[model samples]
Target: MNTRPGLSDTEPAPCLRIGLLWHSVNSPNLGVGALTISNIAIMEKVANELGVSVEFIVLGWMDKSFPVYVQAPNVRALALNGRACKPGGAFSAAVGDCDLVLDIGAGDSFADIYGWRRFLYLAYTKWLVKRAGRPLVLSPQTLGPFKNRLARAIAAFLIRRSDLVFARDRMSVDYARDIGVSRKIIETTDVAFRLPYEKPSPWPGPKEKTVVGINISALLYQGGYTRDNMFQLSIDFPALMDRLLDYFAGIPDCEVVLVPHVLSHRAVEDDLSVCQQVQRAHPGVSVAPAFRSPSEAKSFIAGLDFFIGARMHACIAALSTGVPVAPLAYSRKFMGLFYALDYRDVIDCAAETTESALEAVTLAFGRRDELARMARHSAALAQDRLGIYEDGIKDFLASRIPNRRPAPVAAKSRLSA
Candidate 1:
């Protein structure tokens, strides 16, 4: 492992300079987008505590410019024009100057056709690490089933070279070990654990007896599977929707909210489409507006009595906010998250989803007290895991940057407090 030697204990620097490499900058996908935002926020806190300056190097064209609210004194977003030009050199250039570099890998399902490499972020990061002397830390990320031999070989090489590697699930930890990632590897939770949950919007009418929330991504429903398979999923989804409406319609106080997790032009499992169709079929259920920010989406979900979702982040948002969630998994990442949070009993993906979802929702509602207990447990566990992630970054930097001072106490207080 080649390490840089600018910041040593004898001559410590005032602040550590960090470069963050992320694939989706302006994406509307709530899970990935929220992860990027939350990761930046967490790093900002970490940086402040350490008196570090952080620069986010986003690698794509965004529908909108960088968000103004995310701009702060310690962080800066650098758009690398990833769409029009290759970002390998630019990523290398950015990493070369920083004390440390953090790369967020595509969680599990790395070999899927719609996996992370398809976006070119990993490829660029690999190149950047090869050219730069700074130590690299692979954050708590999901590993792939690795269908592509070439991509897998490259990923294996990168993992082998990283100073520190943290897998988000046991499966990923096992996979990384199998792939020869022999360095310091640890199991940790997703960084989104640090996000603060807000209360949901007030209901326009009297509160319903049960407010069921459902979130889905059209992209997953569109690709990976065959046309026949997708058609089946589409047909089955609507049928399931009807069954749910009929089951809850007679309850009088029950309502449904359909949340579209990703609202982009290319999105295919259109949550809006599902919401519209269900609304038209069942006139009584009311759907909430499409949410754009993580705070808004999470707040809306926080109000639900129960949440059912195909998107992992949607389920995460609900769970993080103390709302009971039954995830409809499309990939291993979903199952990994559920298992990590000890919510395995509640997960049901599209392949396995059926009338059973309705049953799960009912069961979850019945066990609200138990689920609440589990929620607190999961939150504490998530907090402890985040500490591991923070420590991993600190250790990686300390090993490489000799003069790196301990993160400033006042900055750390302001961010973490």
Candidate 2:
């Protein structure tokens, strides 16, 4: 691995510079947006405590400019013109100067399930950072079920190069082990747990009845609702939704609200479109308006009495607020995160049949009280897990550069004669 000239632990640098390499900050997925904001907050808090001048560099010149909720003077967001990732390019120059490089990998795309192109992009970024002689940290991310050797090789190389790696769930940690990542492997909860909750104005769901939030993902909806994924749960999702709607409708004081997490402009990738279809098909089902930020979306989720969602982050929002959530999980990430919370009511869409999915949902609905209590406990636990991440971050920073001054101590009081 290439080494860079960084400040020694004994040397106090007046300024600390970090480069964040991952998906663009502007993301249509609210969950992605939430992660970006939460990460910045985490670093900012550590920087303030260390009493060092901190600066941040984020990749720019993306096809889409998603909204970011940061206004810190210390942080600078710059766009790399074109694909200037090659040496001597503007992008390379910008990141090369930074003291550290942190790859968030958009939280979960460390695997090759998406495609080799996505996997390669991340691997190349790691090589770039290593070449720059900066310490690289892999933030809380899901590793993978690499079906191909090439994907595994790329992932393994990145893991080996990383100075520190944080896996949000045990499954990811195990995967990292499988890839031969032996050191700097730490388990930490998702940063979304720390995102500030902003209460929505004029909440859309009915106040008179028990509000049940149901988020539908465009990914599954577009995939023809099949069981071809890593978890092969045979399901006809539309029918499952109908059955769920029927059950909720029978409850005298319960209301069902369709929450769309992804609002892609493409019809096939937009949850709002699928939600509209469900709204028209079901009499009692209501649809929520598209939210502008993750804060607004999570605020709406916080108000729900119960939540069942396909989007992991939407379910996370509910869980973080102590509102019980049952995830209709198609990925292992859900199983891993929910397991950490000790949440039992999950519909493993990849592993179970439609009938089993329905049974799981019904069981979750019947046990809302138990789930709510567990959620509260989990929320507390989530906070504690975040402490591990904070500690790791502070330790990493302290090793590079220690605080210049120690806090002043007060003189002892003199005793009266």
* Per-model TM-score versus the true fold: 0.82, 0.86
Best by lDDT: 2
Instruction: Give per-residue lDDT, candidate 2, residue 110.
Output: 76
**What is the per-residue lDDT of model 2 for residues 1-417, given as tens digits with 9 covering 90 to 100?**
112245455444456777877734555677766776677778777876665656677753232534554445555665544367667676678777787877787777777776676666667767878887889898887778676887887788878878988888888888878877676688988988887886545546757778898898766765632324423446877678888888889999998899988776756557888899889989678998887677778888988889999989899999999888989987788888878868767788877878889888888888899999999998899889888998898898877754333213211111110
lDDT of each: 0.63, 0.75
Name the weakest run of 10 consecutive residues (lDDT summed) in model 1: 408-417
Badly placed stretches (over 4 Å) of model 2 are 1-13, 60-68, 78-82, 199-207, 224-233, 402-417
TM for candidate 2 is 0.86
> What is candidate 2's local distance difference test score?
0.75
- For model 1, give the RMSD to the true fold: 5.3
